[model samples]
Target: MTDTHPELDDLVLPFSVEPLEARGRITRLGPLVDRILERHAYPPQVARLVGEMVVLAVLLGTSLKFEGRFQLQTRTDGAVDMLVVDFEAPDRVRAYARFDAERLGELAADASPAALLGRGHLALTIDQGSDMSRYQGIVALEGQSIEDAAHQYFLQSEQIPTRIRIAVGETLAGARHTWRAGGVMVQFLPSSPERQRQADLPPGDAPEGATAHVVDEDDAWVEARSLVETVEDHELLDPTLTSETLLYRLFHERGVRVFEAQTVIERCRCSRERIVGMLRQFSPEERRSMVGDDGRIGITCEFCSTHYQVEPAEVGVED
Candidate 1:
């Protein structure tokens, strides 16, 4: 029996996710990458991986039900390094994945996560709401790809079967430094034999009811795994090719439903007021030293690289 619930459609670029099937959705994750790329000029490898994290943050954060933060963190001491992407209310996101900034352009697609990150662990942190305790799940890295790492997280933490395909690459360059990052994720919902009423499940190359079979008394899991396993590296990484078109082309006959989309925007969330507040923490002498001859202070936001100049006198210092 298929899920008869209202379905979502395939979402477009810049933070959108639409339902492509009753139980699945195809997301075109770009514009979000382009925004991040505008702030950076990393190598092909690093840029792609960073995009993957940004997309993953969206897919993993949709159900952040309460008014708090849902954080995805990966800590490592490897060459490529630690990566963290977090999503807050109203679908706001902030991401940073540190690497060999100096040696970035030298990396290749075949580079292993181990070679990039050295050693690491992936974690998901969620702040449900006020007073409620925060929830976090820790999962070990399994492959050189972020998709593989996330798959492991779903199994270990959420105990659900999931398939994740990610593509990271640049579509434009130089004065046109526009790049795109996109991904698709599908998960199986819990089902019971008593509820088995065929809702016309798609005719996937995977075995019939393979998802249910893999866990229970079904044998179709073998077929389903085979279908998902066929997703190719080239297909996932292609920019001109959108996710909806690809998924529809592959499974249209099986009744894949694509739905409405959303947009992902970029925000630094840094303000002069915030920076000024930080400066106040300094002692009188420290503040005086910072003021210099012109009595102006310079502070730069780490994420967006925006610089701010403030006058000491305007702030009104109190001894």
Candidate 2:
């Protein structure tokens, strides 16, 4: 399929290669990522990690068919210890990172994700709002990129044959350079149960001579996985390359078909009214304690850095 639309950014395009019984989505983020990172003013490596998180969140979040939220968070012992990226269903995303500046400064400039994140847990949560139950899956982060952690999530939780490739970098336009990110995720979804069979994980406790259960991978999935693995980092991050063209390059032989693309924007769900409501939940004394020397309570949103000030009296406190 050819994309006639002009080069666009921050959109998720879903596609399928029927011949291989595979389905997947590709996301390209330019201004959306730049806006998120600039708001935080993160260092080079920290910004790159946040950018990668945004790309991964979009790849998984766009898969939701309902109005919900998909959040990717990490708590680790590495220099860049914590990352939080939120994708509200349909098209809004926001992200932030917390790190120890001194620790990060001690690492090599080209530190790997494993090196930056150290050892911790990565969590993916799906929130369906107040009426439904929230679902969360967590996997250990033992020296792996966000891509590797995602693969682990699916392997341990979903049991699906999945492949994910993500890229993040700076692209120069005129004299200014800006952050850009892109990712592609492909999964094998065969119709027949036999074709979907996978080897069972080894038993933790068993006879010493017992062999582990093993099953051969489906050939169609193997072909699809190989093609996806062949994708290079540049292809995903190139500003001039439309996602359609990239997908074509990867699976043109297998005949890929694309669905209508979903657009994503950098937006935070914070507002003065929401902040005020949260303040009201606090006791009058607690709300009063938040007042600054100016005699007004102050709050700043972590995601967007928007500041809100409220008079103590407004929340049932006598100023």
Candidate 3:
């Protein structure tokens, strides 16, 4: 039966399947994604890539138990060279993409993410304020989709069995079309250590004919992954479907329990004070050189496209 629950957006729904020994998160973005894309006006293909990164950021960022920042960044050799998404825990997000417009236009309409991104590395970073240490993980992106890169990060860096599905597209609302994104991530976390055992990484200098060690897959995790694989792209981005309805469709048989949904918003960290402080660091001559014809220093934020006009004297620059 279809869930008639009210459709909501811009929130992460945490859930668990106890019987399957798996837990996961579900997120759907509406205005939150639209605002981010519309502000920058990225090309369609580039916008799609940005959308994917935003969803992935939300999936990983919301897991932080303390106040912190989670950042996802990519530096590549493809048409779309760089992309960044920042999520501030309890609930704020902002994202932007940098691409070679001419190069992006030359690509075919059906270009895959691997084609758009070319070769580079994806980095995920977590910062628990200045007093604490930061953690970061990097994965090479050699002709792979963002989803594929994520899977590799877990297998190599996290050493956990994980599955992820992300979807992004435009939905018609009245006469206008706006961007929307949805993603689901599942990770196996069994109580028994034996159930979480995975094969050891191959040695860098193994004998040419040596036998490789192997580990059997856990039955419960296999079933859980198969279920997540069955989710369709349309189902995820459908405007009428609530996250609750989607989770039910995926794990109703084994039973899924959803916790309180955490709301997410599109908020930029840039502020007038922050901008002023940064400007003060430049040398007096350098600060004077930034003044425009209007007699004020003009600055624009790359993430939110907010323009700032500063007086020459504001940052200790002489007229």
Candidate numbers sorted by lDDT from highest down: 3, 2, 1
lDDT on C-alpha atoms for all candidate structures: 0.62, 0.91, 0.92
lDDT of 2 by residue, 35-72 (tens): 99988899999999999999999999999989999999
Question: Runs in model 2 with CA error above 4 Å?
Answer: 1-7
Model 2: lDDT equals 0.91
Cα deviation of 36, candidate 2, in Å? 0.6
Candidates 2 and 3 compared: the better one by lDDT is: 3
Candidate 3 TM-score to native: 0.96
Regarding lDDT, does 1 or 3 come out ahead? 3
Q: Compared with the true structure, what per-residue lDDT tens digits does model 1 show for residues 1-319?
A: 3321112212432211122212444455546567675676666666666778877887667644556778888887665667777777546777766787655446556776556665578888998778888888887764456777787777666655567776666544446656655566665443553322223334468776575322241233333334446766556555556666676555555545655555445666679998988888888788777775665888877666789998886566542
Between prediction 1 and prediction 2, the one with superior lDDT is: 2
Model 2 alpha-carbon miss at residue 119, Å: 0.9
Error of 1 at 207 (Å): 35
lDDT of 3 by residue, 1-319 (tens): 4433334889899999999999999999988999999888888898899999999999999999999999999999999999999999979999999899899889997799999999999999999999999999999999989998999999999999999999999877779989999999999999998999999889789989988889998999999999999988888888788899899999999999999999999999999999999999999888988999999999999999999999988999875
Q: TM-score winner between 1 and 3, please give it.
A: 3
